[model samples]
Target chain A: MDYSGNGKQFSGKVVTVTSGKGGVGKTTLTANLAAALAADGQKVVCIDGDIGLRNLDVVLGLENRIVYDLVDVVEGRCRLRQAMIRDKRLPELYLIPAAQTRDKNAVSPSDMIRLTNELRPEMDWILIDSPAGIERGFRNAIAPADIVLVVTNPEVSAVRDADRIIGLIEAEEKGPARLVINRIKPAMVKRGEMLSMEDVLELLAIELIGLIPDDEGVVTSSNRGNPIAIEGKSKAAQSFRNIAQRLQGHKVPFLELQEDGNLFGRLARLLRPGGN
Target chain B: MHAVLIKPGTDRNGMEISTKFQIKGIREGLLVTLGDAPWEQVYAALIEHLDEQRDFLKGARLALDVGNHMLKAADLGQIRNQISERDLTLWAVISNSPTTERTAQTLGLETRLSKPKPEPAAQDTRYQDGDPAILVHRTLRSGYSLQNPGHVVILGDVNPGAEIISGGDVIVWGRLRGMVHAGAGGNESAVICALDLAPTQLRIAGVIAITPQRRGKSQPEMVRILNGQVVAEPWNPKKKD
Candidate 1:
């Protein structure tokens, strides 16, 4: 099973943000990636693949506005158009909110593929937030994905989960998966309390796409339903924005995550015009 | 005396000609098709062809592709004994004519090509293009397997659980701690080498070796079949100089 990175150009690209372990920020990356892609004027749709415990609505600040969930649309109770909850802020951004009442078995891989093919003609990106573990939900998430991005934190346990995910992805022929090491704490790494980027890269041995440092603003922004990439500036926001740009085919240099406050300057961060 | 066996004007002298190309090599260490002519001339041409490609045809896998020549197993066995006198093997008889094929099968001669052509990697321009094998310039991790019929030279490590099964030699620039089988078709001369010669299992031709744990650090090592057993020794291409 080998997935060549061949389907990245044109049409709607499905990037499944998956991690094998829970609480490793799969939803955060999904929510932010959706926002990041939409912020660039590309029409984007985020499918919350965690069927029973959906969070794309809450993360994208559309929880109260959800009229119908993914299962309703999949089971044909409602039109496919009725289930998509559009974000008011970003005209190009939409969310096909997950079903809370039912489990992941509510949608199948074929169903996901059909849904994605329908969305393909209208959108530029469809980011699937895959549920944790190598189960049916994970299979459904990656079923329609053109590129699989394995997200993990810079910790031993998170890395183990990522390795397992990478193995599974390769077996599905859905990979040569790229890695996104999220929630990297530079200070902890410097103090040797956390795993370094090199250590994680060594074990994973996959091409790293982005390294997002742990930021306090991420939680507050999630609480308010606006991703940090669009709001108050942080290294993490720039990281996500750079990732979005990279997804759009721009090659961006990696940001050096250093927290010693020393004279050695970090790589230039691309500050967008929206905010500081 | 034998002028009547000739077709009138074609050769008044009645001199026989066996001019078609003969691939008289062993199919599985057996002398297969020698040139097929009229029965007596066919045997004569076979003897002559054996004398010409003497060194190149030595000890090869051979099968005879006799076109419509029907002969009893005793007759074929007699010819085989003759070839065996010269250390040639008669393995298979490939024949379009049913009688000969049946006879060859009865004599236990293989009748078909071994297998279909090997399937190379997808997205490999070299798979369809002329390059037989491509150089992989990185380490092969666990669960990563490479299947190439041509020689495979890796510039990095082959970790445990990884495999490199090649139809030719496999040379690893770094540590080789994985399973590697070279000359997979039983070519005994194929050699495997690495900076740290510590494979979970090493195979060359029909011989296999398990690298014993060394007490000291790793050194460059090479493995080859010696006296019909796989043996690994220190690799020092420069130490001799």
Candidate 2:
């Protein structure tokens, strides 16, 4: 809660999570990643860049603590500290909720650059949850990012939109973006009814950072406004934590996500630990 | 009636639009340089000048050099509509500010004008012969477009949403998965060749064709107009057409 360590000069790395298609897990990943990083004792801040359609605060379980939003800080209506709401559980984590009534055009890309620049020196990580299109909101979120994480589902349409988003990020010189495939069903993939990790990776041709399996715990946790990465022992939670470790420059192997509970599967898991 | 005389030594008589606007002839029609006035005053002067020389400026391609004025998308969109209504095409918008350039790009307007290059002799003699072709070495990602008056050769993949439009032949050394149009200026003899020829849509001259899903591994293929129908043939080195 105390941000008065101005003498410590820790410039934070800004990471923006964006997906071109709506209903992708951009907000969810941002919330969990911030929580996981904060749980590791790293000071992190999450900014909801989707102005008119804010969801990061709700996903982070900090919707009730909103005193001032992003637009209030950008438009100079409030100071930066007043708009940042600290998480109840993790003292190192903060949330800057978006203004629900204001549209995307209310905030410009330069304003986002200026805002993140002000927050860069105090925190260890600044995560921006981008809106679902390649328009003003997406541009605003990526303008200040040192790294961009493109989240996508395993479906064809989501992958197509993710391709477009990756191209746009490359065009804006913020690429090449790391990929995080969410809501993947390993059972369906095994049955050849869904896209496997290899298929998505071949099409996207980007570096893979995280591969999250489809879990019902994610939905339940979201409804309860608690991130699954905080305490849950689900595979999805472990994937988020592994991604955080990867972002921190640790070499963590990808999790093997096959749901076959046979002896061979268990032996394979033992043979190649964290092998995909 | 104040007779605004066009300046001498210029090829076009509509060279001088006004004091605030300087219009000159370039390879791509007219290039207008706007003065360092406020947005409203400059816009007013531009519209007035365009209206005054309506006859001579009709159907002309214009490239506006807007000095450090940081105009938004709405401002650029309004001026583009106005120019289009006056029968003048605004092909490019040159700006000193990065914000304005990005706004222009988002509106699908070119921000830079390529310098005029020497025309190849084959372009004037025969359309099928070797013409000056541009070589792009990088992958054309989605939302990126490459258009040329001659031929285009890409050494990388053309992803799903990218596009390539050429007046002559189109050749891809790598996969061609996006939309491509060859002989866009109505030359049917133009052909498109790719290592893996699976495009969302392909057009040559006035004919359009879509590739069906390949059952197995893809091979190098060539597509062209054969007997008034677009046909794809395997690129055989020994076979001569």
Candidate 3:
């Protein structure tokens, strides 16, 4: 008795990117993952779940194309397809921008589940950018997720917050969330000034899905409203591409952080002059 | 000790009004008595009342007296789950039916309203017990708080941003890095202990302390207020402080 009338054989996997703390690159990871997935010819839609603080559109460079936002779709002011702003460069990518005026309570968890279900048939992946904190916004973002990617920096505070978020995810039974350690400065970690990948893993015991090194190009590309994963040549872009591959069940080896600043690594750096 | 009675009211058009459940504070948490009506109506009314008083009744233990109602195990289990989802523990089921009592017993609920047992000696602290204690088995996350007027014991890590406020001693079998306040009702002798004690903030009665930055690995530590100041020391059962 398959009573669900929406006769669709395929449904996209909903992945939510969330961090308990603000300024930890949740939006950046969502935008880049969407871009990388779309570049791989997968139809991806990114729903900005940060209501009233919507920036995924700006990060994805689809701000100007948003005629109707998520609030419109939930409020019955427009159709779900009408609010989907398709990416011009990547023909398979789309952005469902959050409403700037309404807050997180404007849409409930059931509403998000319905919206993602409606878009499930036509898409391959739905990436949601969750707002910071363990409140209504985070609940809404994770309600429809098949996988939750916890993005965190290699700092004590961020890792602590990520641990708390992981506990909450497990409490909601959406757990065993995969981890993404973003903005790792290898030089600082080598100097023992910053928390290393192992240190972060020791506290938050979760599977590591991606490790993106600190790159200045990410800032410039985000400023220009373009995701670095689209066509950038930085190691950060390659890391995102590897993450996308891993999401598609590809076994990609993690990038070596190159933290050994000894004579051997120094010689290698000197010979190549631009080694990561 | 007396049974509560309720009379149905009449509407403006002279229609009979449906009587709902009543909630009253008792020595043991709250006593919620269902009215003499259909099971569905009484259950719905009870849920509606609980929802309406949610803010005032969070984390309160409850004793449900479903008078003479011969409810099955499924019915009792469903109500218990609903009450737990509202953060209220249904500790006892005071029923007049032996069938209902057996059903409640199968669900691990007490069939009588006995006085809650006092917790055994916790760590090295003594207490003038008043409020009933609660034992939590899962990790407390950020934005999640456990506030009990009695003692609180946790079996998992208390991550940063989580909080526990208790009137008695606070004990953690795992790491404790969150904020905790023992002796919240001003019992200065209350103590806090954890396997790896490194809380963001710790309070005992009127004393407050922050964990100093550790340069070495963490160990099982206990914290208490000694002379108007909070201090932490390794918990060794063989040695005296």
Candidate 4:
């Protein structure tokens, strides 16, 4: 929350979280990853880039403290620091809520770039929660990122959209985007009703960053306006933590998808070129 | 946004009325050849044509043949962006001016038309090779379409929603799951072949066919018009006698 972290000499990195389809857990992943990174002693800020459909503040439980939002900052109605809502739980985490009244045209891609440039010298990570669909909103979110994480589900529709989004990212020269498969049900996959991880990876052909299981704890924590990464021991929470660690350049092995697959299975899969 | 200018000599309500631009169906999509006039006037005429033919031109890939027009980067970029807003993709720009060609290249636009021409004779004056086909080396994802006047050869996968239309034969060295049209200029003998032929739709001249569900594993298949009907057969090198 310190905007004046001068003399530290560490430039912050921008990471954009985007999904081509709606209701695909982009906001959940953003909130949890921001929380996990902050807990790991990295100063992080989450920018809600959904414009009129802003929900990052609500999910982060910082809705009540918002006096200014992204539109206010871009329109020069408030300073960058004045619009950032510092979290009450984690001292290092902050939230920049979006304006609920204006549409995506209220902000431009250059505005996001300039704002991130101003915040780059002070923080460790700047996370932008991109809106669904490939429009001006999506372009605004990705214009300022050093890395992009494309979130998708295991369904055919989600993978199809992810492929299109990946193609667009590559066209913009911002790819290859990393993939994070969320809300995966291992039981359904075993029953031949869902797409396996290998199927998704084969089609996407991108680096696999994280796999989040379907956990009811995510809904419960969201109802209470708290990310599970900050207060739970669920497998989903652990996966988000691992993603945060991977983002920090750590060599963390992927967690086994099956219930009985142990460390040896994971290690063997890693050793083989196309094992799983 | 201007009122369309119909060519003189035809009836006002006639469907055969001409404009300042000529649009012909090509393998790649629709090729729009502009008349030699002021660039601004030609651009305005083109927009009016697209607006008047919006229903017929929706979702069409367009290649502009701007002859001898020395265009700046900003001008070409603006036109490309405006074309996309109209639900049309301007992929190639054929120009005679080197400056214009360089500008189009800078914008990542294709500057060559698929025309069979002899390569610059390097070693022998009597030997020449005329291959009009272009070998694309990357996967064609959704929303991408390639059109050519000659044969088209692809070395990568063609994902769903991607399209390839060629005036001659079409061949894919990898998976072909998208739509394809060979002999788009009405050559009935044109053939379409793929390593794995599971196209959404296949067209040869006047014929159209959809792929059937496979019984087991995939195999190399060739599709062509046989006895006035589009049919597929397994491609076996040993069967060629």
Better of 1 and 4 by DockQ: 4
Model 2 alpha-carbon drift over 4 Å, by segment: A1-9, A260-276, B1-91, B94-108, B111-130, B238-241
lDDT of 4 by residue, B1-241 (tens): 2333333333244423243456767778777877676788778767876887788789999889988678887578567756765778898999989678756754557887664332222322211367467677777776566777777899988877788888778999988888998877777777899998888899987789987766556689999999999999999888766
- lDDT string for model 2 (B97-198, tens) is 977986686566798887323233343323646667888877776777777778899998887788988878899998888899888777788899999887
lDDT of 3 by residue, A177-249 (tens): 9999999888776656667787677667689999999999999999889999999998899999989998887
Q: Distance (Å) between predicted and true CA of A91, model 4?
A: 1.3
Worst 10 residues of 4 chain B by lDDT: B118-127
Expressed as tens digits, the lDDT of each residue in B1-241 for candidate 3 is 5443334454354534344466767778788877677888778767876797799789999999899788986587568757866878898898889768756754557777873333333443455455456788767766566666678999988877789888788999898878999987677888899998878899987788977776456778888888888989898888864
Lowest summed lDDT across 10 adjacent residues in model 2 chain A is found at: A267-276
Task: Give the per-residue Cα lDDT of candidate 2 at B80.
Answer: 75
Which candidate has the highest TM-score of all?
A: 2
Error of 2 at B64 (Å): 4.5
Q: Give the least accurate 10-residue stretch of model 1 chain B, judged by summed lDDT.
A: B1-10
State every prediction's TM-score relative to the real structure. Answer: 0.55, 0.76, 0.70, 0.74
Clashes of 4: 3
Interface RMSD values for all candidates = 22.8, 9.5, 11.4, 7.4
lDDT of 2 at A142: 86
Please identify which of the two predictions, 2 or 4, would achieve the higher DockQ against the true structure. Answer: 2
